[model samples]
Target: MALHFSRDEFASRLELVKARMKEEKLDALLIFAQESMYWLTGYDTFGYCFFQCLVVKADGQMVLMTRSADLRQARHTSIIEDIRIWVDRTNADPAQDLKNLLMDLDLLGSKIGVEYDTHGLTGLNARRLDHQLTSFGTSTDASYIISKLRLVKSAAEIEYAEKAAALSDDALDAALRLAKPGANEADILAAMQGAIFAGGGDYPSNEFIIGSGADALLCRYKAGRRNLDAVDQLTLEWAGVYAHYHAPMMRTVIVGTPNDRQKELYAASRDAIEAIETVLITGNTFGTVFDTHARIMDERGLAKHRLNACGYSVGARFSPSWMEHQMFHAGNPEPILPGMTLFVHMIIMDSETGTAMTLGQTYLITDGPVKSLSRHSLDLISV
Candidate 1:
């Protein structure tokens, strides 16, 4: 098997899940999150876009129900021994197939937990699952069980996270070399991604955010590309992925001489992020971090330009997004724990002045102090 984690590590993870399941009175878990399945059984695939479920019984028994295309994929990449294939055809009901699997496992009348909040489980499929399970078993939305467990990184996961961080720094180095005036956005993006790949990194969970000129104010990835102006700004947000562990970084580079507004924004961003660093500790909650960012930005009179959310937890994830469930937003009660990898960002976009400034980096939360993953300095880049 092409398992990234040791069998013992996988076993430990499974035990943790079972413990949580027991605590929640869940007799079985219909895990639909790809990240959950991969963490539990070393099953890795993008096939989760379709209907697929990993059924885990409280007794430590596990079964996977997926399409035929992933039969060998599971065999090769996962530790799952009991794999069941659901035929894919016109009007095929994989939910029914899942129900059959549950019946076979004698879980028909059991209290099951379903991981419904994920990209892996589409709304249509979720409705199908609920419909199929009606009167068969009691189901509860326990989506956060595995996610909460995954918030703290294990030693092996931390190793991968550190490697990802190194690759992130490398990508920034490559991007900075080509971010000068007249540089093509596409070329800069290619160089950045290339650096990660060259450093033995894996493909990120989502597309890198790359925009220049007026589009620099955009935080999301868009379709087109353009060359850098003689005096322009480039906003980049990218993650270096290694073994599915992510270390993300963001920056809004000033292509030429930065204007007064840009400088002020950058300074505010830097100050806010630094303030956040002091609170990203074991005692502080995710909400506290955001409050610190908001306070600094609002005090600097840039509240309108600041984003509501500061950042989020980063970890092994699938396509569609890299952000974990825990985020730095107002009033979030999620505690900041040791061994958690978090990306803290300060994004300030001023549309009126047509200026953008963003600064972000991933950190490993420890008992003593948070450790920066990226080796790159936080100083504003002007190329």
Candidate 2:
């Protein structure tokens, strides 16, 4: 098997899940999140776009119900032994197949925990699942069970995260080398992604955010690429992924010399980020970090240019997004625990002056003090 973690580590993870299940009085857990499956059993596949489920019973028994296409995929990549394939046909009902699997496992009339909040379980498929299993037993929305468990990184997971951080630094180096006047956004993007791949990194869960000129104010990835102007700004937000663990970084680079507004924005961003770092400790909550960022930015009279949320947790994830459920937003009570990997960003986009400045990096939360994952300097880059 092409397992990324040791069998003992997988077993320990499974035990943690079961312990949480016991606390919640869940007889079985209907895991639909692809990341949860991979974390538990090294089950890797994109076949989760369809109807698939990994059933984890309280007794430590496990079974995977998936399409025939992923039968070998699970066998090769995962440690799951009892794999059942549901046939595909016109109007196939994999939910019914899942019900049968539950029956075979003697889990009928049992309280089950369902991972309802994930891209792996589409709305249509979720409706079908509810329809088939509604009367089977009690099902509760326990989506956060595995996600909360994954918030803290293990030693093995930290190794991958550190490697990902190195790749992120490499990507930034490549981007800076080409970030000059008349440079193509496409080429800069290519060089950045190429650096990650060439450094033995994996594809990120989401597309890298790249934009230049007036579009530099955009935080999301959009279509069309343009050449850098003699005096322009380029915004980039990307992650380095290794073994599915992510270490994301963001920056708005200046082509040629930075203007007055650009310099002011950069200073505010740097100040806010450094201030946020002070409270990124064990006692502070996620909301505390954001409040610090907000206080600094608002005091500097840049509240209008700042985003609502400063940053979020980053770790092993599937396609469509890299952000974890826990985020650094106002009123969030999630504690800042040690062994957690978080991405903190200070983004300032002034459309009034058409200027953009962003500074971000990933950090590992510790008991004493938070540690930055990236080795690159936070100084503003102007090429």
lDDT (tens digit, per residue) of candidate 2 on 241-263:
99999999999998888888988
lDDT, candidate 1, 51-146, per-residue tens: 999999999999999999999999999999999999989999999989988999999789999998999999999999999999799999999999
Q: Over the full model, what C-alpha lDDT does candidate 2 score relative to the true structure?
A: 0.94
The runs of at least 3 residues in candidate 1 whose Cα sits more than 4 Å from the true structure, single-residue gaps closed, are none
Q: What lDDT score belongs to each candidate, Candidate 1 first? A: 0.93, 0.94
Give TM-scores for every candidate, taking all chains together and pairing residue i with residue i: 0.99, 0.99
- Candidate 1: clashing pairs of residues: none
lDDT of 1: 0.93
Top of the candidates by lDDT:
2
